[model samples]
Target: MTTTTRTIPAIADQIVLVTGGARGLGRAITEAFLREGARVVIDYVTSADAAAEIVAAHPGRAVAVRGDVRDRAQVEALFAAGREAFGAPVTTVVNNALADFSFNGDARAKADEIDFPAFAGQFASAVQGALHTVQAALPGFDEAGSGRVINVGTNLFQYPVVPYHDYTAAKAALLSLTRTFSADLGPRGVTVNMVSGGLLRTTDASAATPDAVFDAIAAGTPLLSVTTPAEFADAILFFASPWSRAITGQNLVVDGGLVKD
Candidate 1:
C-alpha cells in the first residue's frame, strides 16, 4: 500500500476517533484533525457541555460520545457509536484520554504516599480502554488493510520526576502496548505509535498543577520552554500522515527537549 503526500487523498475523508477529546490536549487534537479535513469523533467520559459546544462548532465535522474507558462494553459501544455516526472502519484513533491526571498538583500527595489502588486506577483507563478500542477496531482495520493508532502517552516513564508511579506506570504500559500492537497489526498494515509530552500549562486535566511548578518545568527543559497542545497535536498528525508509514512501535516525545529519546 502506498501512502499519499502531506495531504493524502482519503485522509481528509478519514473518520478519526479521539478518546478524551472534549477538552485539553485532546480537544486540540480533535480540532486539529477537523481542520486538516477529517471527520472527527470526540469521545468523553464526562464533560457533556464541553463536548456539546465542541460538536456545535464543527457541525458535520465532529460528533461527541460519552463512555467510561474502564468498562469494556462501554469502550466497544463508544467505537460503535462513532462508527454508526461516521460509518465503520475509522481510519485513525487518538488515545488521549486519561484518568487520575487531575492529581498532578503541588497540593496532591507526594509519590511515596500514593497508593496501589491509585496506580491501578490510572491503567484501568488507558489499558482497558485501549485494549477494547483496538479489539473493536481490529476487524475494520483488517478489512481496510490500513489503519492508525496514535496513542497519547507521557515522557515521565522515560524521565521520572519524583515518581508519580501510577501515571508513569500506565504510560509505560501504554508504550509497551504500542510496540506489541504495532508488531501484531503490521502484517495487515495497521500502524501503532505513541506521542508523549511533559507537563502542560492548561487543560481540565492539568488544572490541578500550579503555575509556578510549570514554570520550573519549563526552566528545566533543554529548550527552556513548555510544549503546547498544537505542537503535540502536530506530532500526532505526523503519525497519521503517510510520511510516517515506515515508522511503528515508536514513541515520539514532544516535551520541548525535557525527555530526549
Candidate 2:
C-alpha cells in the first residue's frame, strides 16, 4: 500500500463560524474545520456550556457564541460577537443550525402534531437562518472577493417516505435557496452549496430513532451501514475547498446510495 495524504491547503489563518456547534453533527462539522487548520467559531442557543467545553479543549483555535437562529436579533448578535472575537469579514460559514430533529415517538409524524405553523418554525430556522447568515456575511465576502457558504440539508425530500412535512419542506426550500444563491453569488466569487445526507446514526439528532427504523434504513441502503457525522463532514470540506472551486449550485448527497435522485 502507498501512503497518501490530503493536499488541501491549510486554512489555519482563515476563520470559519459554524452555527449550532455544541454537539452532535454540528460539533463534527466544527471539528472538521479545526482539523483543516481553520480558526473556528461556534454559535449555539442552549449549548453554551457545551460550547465552553469545546473552547476549553481548543483554546484560541475555537470560540463559541450563544444565540438562537430563529430570532433575527439573536442571529445578528451572534455574528457580531463572532466578528469581535475572530476579526471582521468571516471567510467561511457552514449553516448547520437546525431545530432538534430526534423522532418524538414514531418513525413518521402525524399531520396533527406538526401543522403549518410548525412548518413555518422549521423554515424560519433552516432557510431563514441561511438567508440571514448569507446576508450578514455577503458584504464581508464581497470585500474579500471570495467566500463559501455550505448549507446542511437532509435527504428526506428525495422520496418523502415519512411525513416530516415541516422538516422536509424547510429543507426543500433550503435546497432551492442554495441553488439560487449560488447563481446570484457566483459572479462575486461567493460559492453557495448544500450537502444533503441520509439519516445519520451515532448522532444526537438521530438518537431517539427506534431500532427497527435504524435496521430499516440500514438494510435499504446500498452500503448497509449508517453514515457517520465525521464522514459527512468530509463532503462539507470538499465544497468549502479549492477542489470544489468550480462546483456550486449543487446538492451533494452522502446517503450511501439509498436514493439515486
**Candidate 2 at residue 253, lDDT?**
86
So what's the TM-score on candidate 1? 0.91
Q: Residues 1-261, candidate 2: write the lDDT tens digits.
A: 853332323366567879988888899998888888887879988888888998898887888888777777877776677678877667788999988666534654687665577788888889889988888888777766688899999888996656678898999999999999999988778889999988887788788877787788889889997788999998988888878877789998888888797
Q: How high is the CA lDDT of each candidate model?
A: 0.82, 0.82
lDDT of 1 at 193: 98
lDDT of 1 at 2: 83
Where is the poorest 10-residue window by lDDT in model 2?
Answer: 2-11
Candidate 1 lowest-lDDT run of ten: 3-12
Instruction: Estimate candidate 2's alpha-carbon lDDT, on a 0 to 1 scale.
Output: 0.82
Candidate 1, 1-261: lDDT as tens digits: 985433332558688889999889988998889888998888897778889998998887788889777777877777777778876667788888888467465555576787888878888887877887888777777666688999998888788764677788988999999999999988778889999988776777677777777888899998888888988898999898888878899998999998767
lDDT of 1: 0.82
TM-score of each: 0.91, 0.91
Residue pairs with clashing backbones, model 2: 12-37
